[model samples]
Target: MPSYYDIDAILTDSQKVPCTFEITVPGLGYLDGNPGEPIKEGTKVELPLWLGEMLAVTQNNTNTPTLSLDLPQCLSARVVNALKADPRVVDIRALAPHFYALGSRMLELFDEEELLDVLTDTFKRRAKEIADQAHHPRGVLGEGAEFLRGLDESERQLFRSAHESSKAVRNWMVDLKK
Candidate 1:
């Protein structure tokens, strides 16, 4: 099954702005001697956004950090490009649920409505192409088909219609051969 979440995107966006962290161990001299007070074990300190994320990941048991981010609008464009490049290799729908959840939690996280609309439009267009091509005997459903399957209820309905149309065409061809 295809995953329906973009955890890396969420993590990246979440760590966009610098935030505070509670350190649990010592010996992180690299992050010390900066503008702010030196980071020490057992003390709370503020760190740069990227640094904080790195430290939190590297020193999981040693730091507890908070993050907030404003997801960039370009993300959707990137996704669209990836889908266009190889809809069979890219599952754009995988990001829908995560986008929805994150957008709900953080209104400013992303242009949720716009992203959803764009994704739906792109998926529909690509799915139609796939369906049309599917009538060929050798056509193979790939990641694009999986992406369509992962769509939300309404979007899935659209894919289902296209798929049904393709099926009908295939049956008609078989009847003609008979």
Candidate 2:
């Protein structure tokens, strides 16, 4: 579970997801760029996860949800297939800054075993690359610059931690050598 003040969690929730309305919502046309008109039934809109999740899970008088959430385009088959082909090559940051975090949240709402597997494998593969980049002396001018730029928020943090730890260890070793 994400903390109440987790900025990454907030951003992840703010990311848009496609939603199809099961019922017409009156005076909510602002969501679809029309004011004062009801959003019609079967209308599809891209809504933020926070609002969409609430609307999706809420039971109306009929005991059915008002709308249904679909996987975001960031997690579409194309992106998944790319990751399956080469996890290190896909620009996950372009898809979503908090890609893995959003994936975890989606997995909670959806029962997708394949998505889980792909995400896990992708993370494991990219983690090795991130660690290598962190330990290596290749600065921004290095060959891995493009790959480093594609890392998601969590991976960025991991790289920072790994880099900092290595730096700290080197400093400690120098102090001991004195």
Candidate 3:
């Protein structure tokens, strides 16, 4: 399960989900299910709002959830490190399932404001399941790029672009003072 914030988006055409997300990773964006879908970088793309929230929530939280627009460098790294240090995760490193089986019961709730509550509850349950698996059965990505690699292509590309941009912003911080 992933955590989510209270971000809002209006529904667009059925073709485009209510939320749009632009992906900008050179080779990361591949519309595996939607054939011939153009992969655009440095541009805006609309995806289902639920998808965007998933990306957003996972990026923001370690175990507890917090919403901050700016990437929390130390915080994100701390969670990743904690997960990595966990004995359960380290021992299961060898199975390397390549992907965790997300419960089909999992569904993204968005496009309507009311769904947020439903989403909130769903996210908590899912997060608990994930944390459990982290501590016991099944392996995890250890809360970083390593964990992110476990994502499917579409989601992975989205994260890559966000991460790449965040890195650029972080690198420019020192120069910004000048």
Q: Pick the candidate with the highest lDDT.
A: 2
* lDDT, candidate 1, 114-133, per-residue tens: 65655555555656655554
TM-score (all chains, Cα) for each model: 0.32, 0.97, 0.23
Best model per TM-score: 2
lDDT at 10, model 2:
95
What are the per-residue Cα lDDT tens digits for candidate 3 across 70-140?
A: 21121133433443444223221222221111111122231333333433443343344444433342334
Q: Residue 139 in model 2: shift from native, Å?
A: 1.5
lDDT of each: 0.48, 0.95, 0.34
Candidate 2 Cα errors over 4 Å, as ranges:
none
Q: How well is each residue in 1-178 modelled by candidate 2, as lDDT tens digits?
A: 7799999999999999999999998999999899999998999999999999999999889988999999999999999999899999999999999999999999999999999999999999999999999989588889999999999999999999999999999999999999
Error of 3 at 7 (Å): 28
What RMSD, rounded to one decimal, does every model reach? 10.4, 0.8, 19.4
Candidate 3: regions farther than 4 A off: 1-146
Consecutive 10-residue window with the lowest summed lDDT within model 1: 65-74
User: After TM-score superposition, what is the CA distance of residue 42 in candidate 3 from its true location, in Å?
Assistant: 49
Residue 33 of candidate 1: its Cα lDDT? 51
